[model samples]
Target: MNEQIVITFGNEKILTELKAAHPDRDLMMYQALSQPGEFMLLDHSGKDSVFKAPVFYDILSHSGEDKWDGFISFSTLDLNFDQQKVFDARINKLRTNGLPDGMHSIYSLNYHKDISQRIILGTWDDYADFELWKNSSDEFIPKEYRDSPNFYSHEAYYTPAKTKKTQ
Candidate 1:
């Protein structure tokens, strides 16, 4: 039973309950049909139900194994990007600008689903280069993150999940 738990629109009961529980905290819960195990969390800090979902996420664990091999998707904008750059160059950038098989479509591996343990890390494929991704210099599939030792990366940080569930 090695399945990762996620929030879904069909869980309206949970959603409504979550919404009612933290009315003061903003929430943007929705269902994205394109990706199944996917859930949208737009600035969802105080209102992340994944922390309170079930036994699965309640004791969340992360692996730096081979399957985490996806892009850190992000929209092509300077808004959060620049701030993120200021924050650190190596943080997982999971969102996208909607291009043909682009980063926006590669959300599975880039964000943190920090569950019970309170911290999960998202590492990029070593070839991660914003300038390269946006440029027409060359088009090619990227190698694994372990390919280059010189690859720039962000220092690991701890993000505490909501240990208390209203439900």
Candidate 2:
């Protein structure tokens, strides 16, 4: 399936390194309008295309993908250090135990700080699948992670209607 991914870097140094590492990859790089020095790299390509770049796994703290024209969702969680560890462990468990049903692709990013932001980007096979994953209870997620009062989560969903190509 054709895929769309968004990766954000906090500085030019990392961005430069990414460009140097993936000279042949097709990427749309732009500075964040609101956050100076922060760059966002967008790529739309075949399945698992982004995995070819070593820097994607190395420097990128935030990354997510959606199938072209399909359902995509993003969530940002703010958590403390202990909560972050629990969250990471839960994510690892989910990875090893298999993702919730209908999840096509999922990405977890932790922007470490006092109240770190843990962002999750996920795509589903269809709207129904997306709904299924969204409405699922704490059974799908770890209990401590779910019950944690020290964290806050915000989520948004998107469906692309058209694509604009710019030269």
Off-target runs (Cα >4 Å) in candidate 2 are: 1-41, 44-69, 112-115, 139-150, 164-167
TM-score of 2: 0.54
Q: What's the CA error at residue 20 for candidate 1, in Å?
A: 2.7
Model 2: clashing residue pairs?
none
Candidate 1 backbone collisions, by pair: 72-93, 73-94, 73-95, 74-95, 74-96, 75-96, 90-154, 96-104, 126-145
- Predicted candidate 2 versus true structure: per-residue lDDT over 34-133, tens digit per residue: 3454554445332244433322221122223434335556577777777667777766666666666667666665443223766666666666786776
RMSD value for candidate 2 = 8.7
Best by TM-score: 2
Give a tens-digit lDDT track for model 1, residues 11-91: 445555665666665544433333443343222232334434332232122233321223332222111334333322222
